[model samples]
Target: MEVVVGVDLGGTKISAALVDESGNIVADVRCHTQVEKGREFVIEQLTKTVGELFERAEGLGKRVLAIGIGSPGIIDPDSGVVVKAAVNLPQWEGISLKRIFEERFNVVAFADNDVNVMALGESLFGVAKGLKNVIFIAIGTGIGGGIVVDGKLYHGSTFTAGEIGHMTILPEGPKCACGNYGCLEALASGPSIARRAKEYIAKGVATSLSELVDDEITCEHVAKAASKGDALCRRLLEEAGRYIGVAVASLMNVLNPDCVVIGGGVAQAGEILLTPIRHEVALRAISPAPVLQSLLRENAGEIGAAALAFSKLAEKD
Candidate 1:
């Protein structure tokens, strides 16, 4: 069996999987990313994960082909370098992820922004399949996006075109981690949702969510509470969905994409979130398209990474 390695590298964790040509996972491994320990430690963790995958491949009579990495931040997709990123990964500036991995593993490698590859995954195997124009939104701890136009990923002039989270929806709302006030991220992301719940609790509002997670309340807790009919959590999620809808509506009006996809941890809240997002998009959009959830979900990152490698390689051929 021949397989490509796909890595989903994030702030909190790293997941690597060996995938065959048909998108089947031959083997996989994951580990917590102690990013605070410095770049070298992070590299060590990646090496261990990949090395384990290679070992498993050998044991399973598989021939490893190449590597694909989906990492957070502005990656030079053509060159496979991490140009810049947020504080999540510390001093991760100007690192050539492709060069480093190819040198270490002695194989071809490609790297890209996490959400970009995820969008690619959707285009290839998920909701946006066969669409010429598409938009993908990730609503996790933070928010991010990817855009495809004319069946090609749009990198924009600066390669940062899809930072949808920074779009200003609330002109005077809460400050985001990016130091921008009223960013969609600060208003609609998972952390933002949890923050809203926390704010209500601070105001002495009565909600069972407080009893669920105490001061350590998270977005998952809010979603869980909402599922159980907790009115406060439902209200918070609906508000976040509306905020997301505003942004999505804005994008749809400008891009006129055939499809838009919502993925990431918060998206798992399902219809509670999607319903309001749909309502807002329908209300505000000039030419509306259906908003749908990701079919791949957690697997999108790794699968998309593999798909990224395959696509780039095919282009080379």
Candidate 2:
């Protein structure tokens, strides 16, 4: 059997899996990123994990075909280098992941933005499977998106097409990390939601959310509070949902996708967030779509990486 290695490189862990063409995992390994140890350390960890998978695949009599990776930061798709990285991946800039892995494993390799791989995974196997046009929004520390158009991932002219989080949601509102005012990430991302909760506490809002956390407030705390029926937490998440909905509604009209999939840690809040988002989408969209949570959840990245390799290999063929 011929299999490809699909790797998901994250701030905390690097997961590598040997996946068959049908999106089935033949072998897998996970290792800590140890990001604080710097860029080379993280790369070493990735090599170790992928090496383990290679051994496992060999044991199972599977021939390794290629490697595909999904990682954070601005990637040069052609070179597979991280052009810029987010804060989570310190000093990861300019690392050529594809070059390193391909040389190490002696196989062709592919890499791209994590969310872009995620969109491909969704289209090929996950919730959005069987759909021709799909959009994937990941709401976590920040909101990122991937757009699949007409059964293919659209990389735009410069290979940076899926930046749904940067869309301006509130024209004179909060300043975003990208130095823009009121981008969707600023308004509805996990940190932004947590910040809103902190703002409420500063104003002495009567919410039990503050009592639920052990440290500085986090989106998880708010989500937990909302799950427990804390009115303030519910309202906070719902408000974020509404903002997300507004942006999604705009996407629905402009892209005309069959569905929009939401994933990431913050999306784990379930209906408290989705309810408001769905309502707002219903109210605002010229064309509405099913707003659904990711079925793949934590596995999306690894599986998505495999899907990326499959797509790229197909293009070569």
Give the count of colliding residue pairs in each prediction: 0, 0
What's the C-alpha lDDT at position 235 in model 2?
Answer: 95
Q: lDDT per residue, candidate 2, 1-317, as tens digits?
A: 99889999999888888989878877788887898887887888888898998899889999888899999987888899988886799687888989999989899999999999989898887988889899999999888899999877888887778899999999999999989999999999999999999888889899987575535889998999899999989999999999999999999999989999999899999999999999999999998999989877888899999988888888899
Off by over 4 Å in 1: 212-214
Go through the candidates in order and give each one's C-alpha lDDT: 0.90, 0.89
Query: What TM-scores do the predictions have?
Result: 0.94, 0.94
Writing each residue's lDDT as its tens digit, candidate 1 over 1-317 gives 78989999989999999988877788899999998899999999998899899899999999888999999989998888888875788578889889888999998999999999888888877887878788999999899999988766789877898999999998899999999899999999988899899889989898997776556899999999899999999999999999999999999999999989999999999999999999999999999998989988989999889978877777789
Cand. 2 TM to true fold: 0.94
The candidate 1 region of ten consecutive residues with least summed lDDT is: 208-217
Give every collision pair in model 2: none
Enumerate residue pairs that collide in model 1: none
Displacement of residue 216 (Cα, Å) in model 2 is 2.3
